[model samples]
Target: MSRRKKTSPAEDVVDLIALLPWYVGVILALAGYLLLHRIAIAPLPSALGPGALGNAMVGTMGRGLATAGQYIVPIFCLAGAAISAWRRHARRSLMDNVARSDGPDILDDMSWREFEILVGEGFRLQGYQVAENFEAGPDDGIDLTLRKNGEKYLVQCKQWRAFKVGVPVVRELYGVMAAEGAAGGFVVTSGRFTPEAEAFASGRNLRLLDGPQLHRLLKQARGSSSAKPAADIRATEQASNAAPQAAKTAAPSCPRCAQPMVRRTARKGVNAGQEFWGCSSYPRCRGTA
Candidate 1:
């Protein structure tokens, strides 16, 4: 069997307009100038049978459109280049910060924009190229769009500190995931999630990242984004495995420790051989179902 070749990050992303050869935009601006100059020097269409007044109107309208194009085309060219440059710089800076950060704890202190940038960096670390959306409002239903291995995933970052993220947030993301045909969806919060939210996400193409998991991912991202000459394959693998505990979501948690519970049987009592849920921590936490 043949193995599939991996695409370099540089090969994964290309904006046709933004990455246009410098000569393209220069030629467009040059065309705009020639358009305006042509109108100023050339006579109106000799074939048009319009009388003197109609011809004057036609010439004025033609010149007006050319005048507007002379400004609009160059402005659009400049804007695309500017946006592409800004995105490149932002990604570089975000990766730099990721390598230097102690943990995701800093996420709590960051503004929404910074959090969004941090999230983009996190995905980029996982071999994804992220397209960010800054509107925190309820429009578009997606905050970050990520593509990896020819699959699209949507991510929403909720920095809500005081609330246990609820089911509606996850449900809403799932709904948009269906509409957008995303391979999977993730809702990340710098806080805990409600039991209902976890229940809703289980057994589906959804992953919920609580504060602790986010912390682990950031540490993983730091290694991946480091100045090291080569990729940290081990760190990325570890982080990907820990990103979402899909199996644990279906398992019951220990009531006392609030940690995942393990199944066990009573060893020496009348209840011997009877299976029951026990705390994974054992004697340290005697919690049971």
Candidate 2:
């Protein structure tokens, strides 16, 4: 058995925070500094009363810890934020590159972590909230947990390049899904699946994505992402154009007649084609705005 490498406390803190969004890490950094700085500068208690010596000792120790932590904690948090940002960018880049590539050969070029990131990003683009398991080893089962429309899904990623992912991996994910109450599961690989693996996934809520299928998924996700900006622009334009109509339709009661106002256009004046509120009692109490 191989022993896990020992990490310093600071490194562990950074790793823990790096699993969160970069903005969360930044918030934690600010909060940690503010709170710790307040404690670091707090005045010591008086030593002239009962148990005052112990109180003074405790205060001194607390202040000492806070003094160091004020700087150290924020530094770790910011470092984690930086790491998160870098990973975010790397994941997007990996998906983009693979989606634009001609074949699945590019998938084999990535590390296991990169493969998992790619899978998570794909699910995220498809409107799922994905939680990547960065702490899991290569063969430790589920690499990602996905949630969408109030249902949970587990994903196992196999970055094996040389051999086909077999029934055992798919079976492991299915068992985990049952035990964890997952709604479904996916087994993604950078290689083909064995016939047994495909057979096992059949007739279940499990989906097995081999290398080519994964490539196609990334491509479709990229297409959908690329279409979003155009759709958003069109929606903004529609909203802007509808503002004048909304103003015209939402007219207050006529001040002169107390009747509902109707939207009318200036027919033959300098404001021709411009809309305004006209009284519903048009030929009698003519009120215009």
Off by over 4 Å in 2: 1-6, 136-139, 235-289
Candidate 1 local distance difference test against the native: 0.73
Over all chains combined, what TM-score does candidate 1 have? 0.58
Estimate the TM-score of every prediction. 0.58, 0.77
Which TM-score value belongs to model 2?
0.77
Leading candidate by lDDT: 2
**Cα lDDT of model 2 by residue, 1-289, tens digit:** 0124436766777887888999999999999999999999988765459768877888899999999999998999999999999989998899879878999999999888788889899999999999866552343487889999999999988898999999988898899899999999999999999999999999999999999999999999999899999999999999999999987568799999899988888988799999888999989988986
What candidate 1 gets wrong by more than 4 Å, as runs, is: 1-59, 134-137, 225-289
Error of 1 at 83 (Å): 4.0
